[model samples]
Target chain A: MVDVSQASGAEGPAISMRSRLSPYALPIFLIALIAVSGIVSPAFLSTSNISNMLLQVAPLGIVVIGQAFVIILRGLDLSVSSVMATAAVIATGFSGQNSDVLSILLIAVGIGIATGLVNGWLVTKRSVSPFLATLATMIVLQGFRFAYTQGAPSGNVPPLFRLIGSATWHGVPYNMMLLVVLAIVFGVVLAKSRFGREVYITGGSPTTARLLGINADRVTIIGYVISGALAAIAGLVLSGYVGIVDNWVGRGFELDSIVAAVMGGISLSGGQGGILGGLFGAAILVVVFNAVLLFGLPVQLQIIIKGMVIVLAAAFYVRRRI
Target chain B: MTALAPIRLSSRLRANQGVLVVAALLVILLIFGAFISDRFRTTSNILNIFEQSTGLALVSLGQTLAILTGGIDLSVGSMISLLSTLTSGLIAGKVSMVLPVAIGILLLGLLIGICNGLLIIWLRVHPLIVTLGMSAVLQGIVLLYSLGPAGSVPPSFNFLAYGKVLGLPIGAVFILVLFLLVALFLRYARLGRYIYAVGDDEVGARLMGLPRARVMLTVYGFSGFCCGLTAIYLTSRFSVGQPYTGLNYTLASITPVVVGGTLLSGGKGGVFGTLLGVYLVSLINNVLNFMDVSTHYQLIAQGLIVIAAVSIYVEKKKRV
Candidate 1:
């Protein structure tokens, strides 16, 4: 890592060097994981295997995008798992034949927005704590999923839906393409947009943001809305990829998203992290996840590893945690 | 300063703010229950409420202390489940082994709590993340230990949960006594007061020369201990220890704590309001069951109640 202190100082030689690797430092770890996975099982490096991993990463990566935003605001959304499940169920249950895909996607996104709005409203207007508020939504949503699914959730994903999950064009996975597009768009929005700057300001220091006339509540609400909408998209993608409607689908993504965000160097203390960094985090986590699967580790042990990662990553990266 | 101290001190109690609200809710629930069914009005059924709520009451006590210190122990649910499986698996229906095993489980819980405290302090991470991570690790351990209910306790041990003292459930009565003692300790004790001080302002509390590390460690330890007690009680009640025993507890425990008027930001809540909160939750469940509501809807109802109660509490706190 380039020493920021020296690099930013009058060291003429260092001043010209842009440490691109230092920024997305996670890539080195990602490369090492790929190398190890390939060595452990030669088939792991196969294009098919790599694409399969990307398919898994896509939904989780999108969810991480949303989770990263919330983390940037020093808030949490335990409701994402429920939100994701609800979205997936709504899409397949309501779609019936998968005609008019826009409507189903819209409805799913609508649920996400409404859920996010309620969460934000409760936190800002009603003064409920972020985690508890979302947790309530999570509970209510779980019941809703139970009630809605009945025995089996309605309908199946359309063949066209596989375009995003499985179909590839020019040797690139479609889901990866969509994810790349999302990363660029949202990444730019977070890094360059006025709203993004406001997010950082409000999150980093509410008092200072207030002095600067930023509406912290508005930023918080919008952040949640984006998170909710993105979570819905991720859920829809997951459900579509699975091609079935099950209540347990996307069950633990809330925690996964947090882990990804933390791994991506998104500080829980707020006002840091970017979309690209989060994607890297998502990629790293998914690679590790695939490694666990390839090694045939039990689900129980996978859970232990995940928990350990969240703790270790947060301890390493989250400044001002105390 | 002396003249205002008691008033200010009383105001600082978390349970005071929502004591009346939860009490009022309980009264309304009781009346509603009475009107709803003859089954609900019976003394046996009334006692049943306390008995069923004992598990939550025990778990929430530890949660209360954790929240009081401006941190939360998400591990308690997993701890409860893990300890339950261990307590039952180790005892294995042997009377001679029960005492030793139960004590060992409680000590293990304490050890986990201390580990949580050490991790938070050493790593300089919030307890939420540390405990959350620990919860996952413990949950995996539970799953690895048993896919289902693993073992049983002797019939004689069942009395811990089922036995009554003067018509009240043993678990409920004992838990009530425990709550009262903790309330008194929080009110009259120095260490107890330090909990509130740390929650209200950690830096200020440290500047006051309080032992913040000891306070954090002990609070988490108490939370773990409470989970241990709950596990034993659950094993006694169910006769078998299950992996999913405390599945809903992590979230369920917080409902009573926050609705009891404890701020999520920590500080300013007491166990008394939590006692009322427990009763209120029990009453709500009882009323719902009497109404023949689906168990699925019961989750929604509980969650809705949490949201409503929290909103009202937040409004009340802000006004103050």
Candidate 2:
């Protein structure tokens, strides 16, 4: 008997109620899980357990921020892992004492921007669909990484850079803080700025925004560039942590980011979501992954579970999509 | 009027596709081949190109179908991996090659196709997410089955991949059969028209009473079936089943599908064009190999070509 529109309007309160309560759900679940683990072993919530959890979440969280931006524009960047791998290798290659670390970082970021330029150029100017174009970029970049690395990664990070991965400042890891700062910056950009409004407008209705002369192409390009740059930053973080460069350094990162975005209540169709949603989603994913390890699951089984979570996230979004 | 004329002209710049770019690249490649190497023009080399393209050709054909429906299949590569893994392991375990291969491959295809369809339809998930999840699931299953590297296909199986009849590779025959079947279905069948109709405008198709879900389900299912067939030859040709073998095809398959004149937005291209696209990509790979260019450079070039092809398509579509 409830009209659909009326029902949707009513959904606001319901969703807010759900949102307010949902944060506690995961934490509660984690605590319960910890209690169970404690029952099994007194060391379940030990320092190493928490550090390991943070370590796994840090790299994925950095990439997910980039993923969040692109998804907000109703686009995808499938090349994040490849970008990470390529950037990581590039970063590692410049690890010598005499090597210009700053220049290498710039060059690595430049590589990402270049990739983004191609990706954005095709999508905006060439009219390639975001899905296919990004996917192609991903493959090519992956291949490029493999070719450049010659399937063997020998470069090591300089000690200073390695500290970013292994060292913590004021009892917090630099990478984790990097993620927190990015979350705030992204939060403001999407929620406060003129560019952010343009993003929402462009995503909601590109043609309508065009009629208003919002420069849809430019906005889109900026969004993708941000994604690419952030992904490169993610590579930098990963390089600092992993110590050694490998060809597959960022493998399957695109999926992880997408999953995080969806979990954060950012609709895949675009123009809906906040930084909080994205961050929360990333937290949830990391927690679940930690849950898997804490629960003693095998690696292959973990992969399968992650895949299931992705599908379930999509399914959840579809059900709640307005 | 003159100043306005350019604006009008610019709007017309977006053509439906820039297939001509690929055609030009094809010509350039041929010219390069002629200039660089004599073996390029030989019958055997050309035959070898056709033979080499079989797996990709099949996958591209499936990609074309998926793209036509305004969707994609990330699961195809995973499907290939699973089929290759299962086929090799089963064969190695002394399972009869003939019946087991046929039934096992078909059943997996159906299962995968149905799983994809059901998830997409009933759960209302995007094709990308569903297939991506399916890809991981398939990878898990394949890994579970093989547990590691599986045995190579019996040499006799390779005959389908390596054999020739009257100076033609059997792969050429398989390609021909697949093309004809696809061509016939798309050209003369009710389902075929329905596919194009749905691709053009799903809402319009629905208004016209097309079975949109059915068509989508069928196309995806058929894509999975083709993966099975492709896997049969893959095991034969490679002589081994690799858990990671099919990952590269995810992108390589799309190059041909996009190059074949299909719109990634869906409902605008067909298998014949995909066949041509496949041939073009196949030829490029072979020519690159013949020229002795390092594979790394070849990959970079291939990536550039993909961007160029899609960019051209986008430009052409805007013109139209």
Candidate 3:
């Protein structure tokens, strides 16, 4: 409604314009990193290298899109990484080397819906904090994965998955194409739809949203379900790319998604930013990771650097807001 | 007068509800354990539970402090990992080096905690993000320090875990002493009450002239100190310096605090409650072991218990 827009207008056009420019920082930084990478390694900008980087970023970007939606509702999906892992295990374990891709996909989606519903129920119906509820879901799901696998998950990802995960069409990775389509669809929905507007209103203030007749609980639950489903899709794609599944399949993704979302200008407090910003953030992260690999640094050093970058990015954004 | 009496009784129950719930859960678990296994009632088994609970108890003490101030420290697990790796690498079976190594590890913990506190307060970053980032950094540092499981602690260091003092394991005795000291401090100290006040309502506490930033710093720093202590125990118990030794410790530590009936939202929990929580979890694990149930079931149970416990507390608060 115009009420929300009118309320935001009181902040003045200058502030709004500044916020508009703020989202570009991540993409600019990504470009600078890419330039630096090319200088460090002449082959870094090669088509093969670039395509590989895109492939790496695709799954994360998809997951961050989902994370963005949840953050917009002032909630965090800490269970995302675990959900991804579960999906990967389920997809492979269910297919059982026979490559029953359709059933595997169905089961993965079903798991996502079920986990999301549980999270939503705990948070909404039971009145548990989102952080704790998602955290509990993460732990339980992780345990379920271990129990199902009994410490070792067996089975290979089907060829159909491999095609979507790793295959390219005319020099463009299928994964990247999928990401672009998803990004556009989500971006349009978030930017133009009434549901998206309701999400923003809820994130800004649940009480205010409820007073305006928005079903804040329903919006919040839907946001979580979308996040869970996307995370599962990303996991499925990752499984296909790796062609194997393991306990540590999606390790660090939860943190990485948060970092990327935040870096992309998605406010941690919620009700700000967009899908494009999250995509840029994911791209920047993948680029930095690619650069680190090219520099011949140890994996430990890469993690240390990534951690420092997250802290620094957060600090920078906080300072800018002030 | 009759209505007043009922109201008073309900109010009294509400005031002590967290403690009562935890106590009831502990009793139920004990009864369940005794009914299920002969080993559960044995003196040695009970002592073993206490011994196993010592590390978690210490970590939960720190977590209780942090949560009391309405913040969290996800880096505690990583802090334990770093401390243990450093201590074992430095001590390397040298009894003479224990004091200095221990001091060094604790100091690092203090430094890490201070950094977290300062960043959260000065930079105005959320404690969750800062601590999560710090956890990653600490993990990376641990991995860098030791690529694999390396370093052996001295036989004397093992005494911390294996030693018996006055018919009790030394670790359990230490835990009890620390718990009592913290309980007394929370009951009597100015800063302790300030932590509760701040967590309950930060702005109100600020307006009341409480040193808000200082309280936050001290809680986080103390939490780090606890992690250092936990690291010492873990290293002693495991006898190895592994990079990933305390991978689940952060969540494990938090679970007991919440299960002990501390509101994750903060301001209403104590070290004693956390101790009860630690024991409850340790007892559950012990019972599961005795019952020959898979460890995964324990994980599922723990997750469910935290959700259930927090839900009950929320429901009760709503009623009140």
Best by lDDT: 3
What TM-score does the A-chain of candidate 2 achieve?
0.87
DockQ, every prediction: 0.56, 0.43, 0.53
**CAPRI band for model 1:** medium
Q: What is the TM-score of chain B alone in each candidate?
A: 0.93, 0.89, 0.94
- Across A124-241, the per-residue lDDT of candidate 3 in tens digits comes to 7777777778888999998888999998988888888888899899988999989999999988888889998998888877778889899888888888898999999999999888
Error of 3 at B152 (Å): 1.2
Regarding lDDT, does 1 or 3 come out ahead? Answer: 3
Ordered list by TM-score, greatest first: 3, 1, 2
Cα lDDT tens digits for candidate 2, A179-206: 8888888878877788887777677656
**Model 2 segments more than 4 A misplaced:** A1-44, A319-322, B1-28, B93-95, B315-320
For candidate 2, write residues B1-320 as lDDT tens digits. Answer: 88899887665443423455567777888888878888898888889889999999888888788878878888988889888877777787354665677688877886787779788887878788888889888887787666666876666777879899888998888798879898899999999989889878877888888898898889888888888888877888887787877877877888887787788777887887788788898888888899887887777777777887777665333211
Which of the two, 2 or 3, has more lDDT? 3
Error of 1 at B12 (Å): 8.4
Clashes of 1: 4
Q: B215-295, model 1: which lDDT tens digit per residue?
A: 889988888888899999999999989888888999889889877888777777889878888888888888888898888
Which of the CAPRI classes, incorrect, acceptable, medium or high, describes model 2?
Answer: acceptable
DockQ measured for candidate 2: 0.43
Backbone collisions counted per model:
4, 9, 0
